[model samples]
Target: MSVSQQVIKDKLQASIGDIYHIIITDTSNGCGQSFDVIVVSDTFEGKNKLQRCRLVNGALKEEVAQIHAFGCKCFTTAEWSKLVV
Candidate 1:
């Protein structure tokens, strides 16, 4: 597609402040378009998965409109620590 991985990362960096690693993939480009964004920010604190997804959806409305889908996994720094999977 027209957007590059770094571009997506940058957009996310701007939109989702405090993100630790804004990993992006573009399946549309036959690479890894399906993003697995690991954001370690307080912004995601208290927000459930659905709410986090919605927040990401709203934040990336412009990019979302262009992409096929999003494989989002947002988490707070604390929540990320408790993950076993």
Candidate 2:
């Protein structure tokens, strides 16, 4: 069975907390084999890109194993503010 975008969003939100936004896109021709994710949260503060990626990877460990492609962009609240404005 494949996971829905809402399920992915909920799981990340539960693990990371204090999220400004969570966007998950299914990019596998509707097969649910690939996903692109953007996560904005205060939990990523003080973490480097790799560290932030690791945090997301850890949160979605089991789900990722089933996916063939996973692309993630993570940002802190401050970083997101900078990017948006």
Candidate 3:
């Protein structure tokens, strides 16, 4: 079964607590095999890139198993704010 973008978004929101921004792109041409994502949340505040990815991966453990490719960029709220400005 292919996972929808919204389902992934909801999962992230539920697992990560409060999120400032989330961008998810279906890079597998709607087959749900690949996705590129950007997530901004305070949950990443003290974590390095690997740790942040682990959190996201842990949250989406089942989904990640099904997906062929998944790429994610995680940032703290403060880091995201600087990039957007």
Candidate 4:
């Protein structure tokens, strides 16, 4: 079974809380086995890179286990604002 992009996006929003922005991409060409993601949230404000990764991984624990590959870049709203500017 494969995961849908919406499922992942929804789960992150539900689990992470206070999401300011999010982008989810299907990287497996419809196989749903791989994804590339970016999440911007206040929940990440005080967290480091590893901590952010762990939070995202924990939120998507089951999905991550089932998928062949998953890549996520997490940031605080402040960090994201800087990047987009």
Candidate with the greatest lDDT versus the true structure: 4
TM-scores for every candidate against the unseen true structure: 0.72, 0.91, 0.94, 0.94
What is the clash count for each candidate, in the order shown? 5, 0, 0, 0
lDDT of 4 by residue, 1-85 (tens): 4589989988998899899999999988998999999999989887889999999999999999999999999988889999999
Q: Which window of ten consecutive residues has the lowest lDDT sum in model 2?
A: 1-10
Model 1 residue runs over 4 Å out of place are: 28-34
Return the number of clashes found in candidate 1.
Answer: 5
State residue 57's C-alpha deviation in candidate 4, in Å.
0.4
Per-residue lDDT tens digits for candidate 3, residues 32-77, read 9999889999989889999999999888888889999999999998
Q: How would you encode candidate 2's per-residue C-alpha lDDT over 1-85 as one tens digit per residue? A: 4677877887798888788998899999888889999999988988899998898888888889988999999998888889998
User: Whole-model lDDT, candidate 3?
Assistant: 0.91
**What is the C-alpha local distance difference test score of each model?**
0.68, 0.88, 0.91, 0.92
Worst 10 residues of 3 by lDDT: 1-10
Q: In angstroms, how far off is 39's CA in candidate 1?
A: 2.7
How high a TM-score does candidate 4 get? 0.94
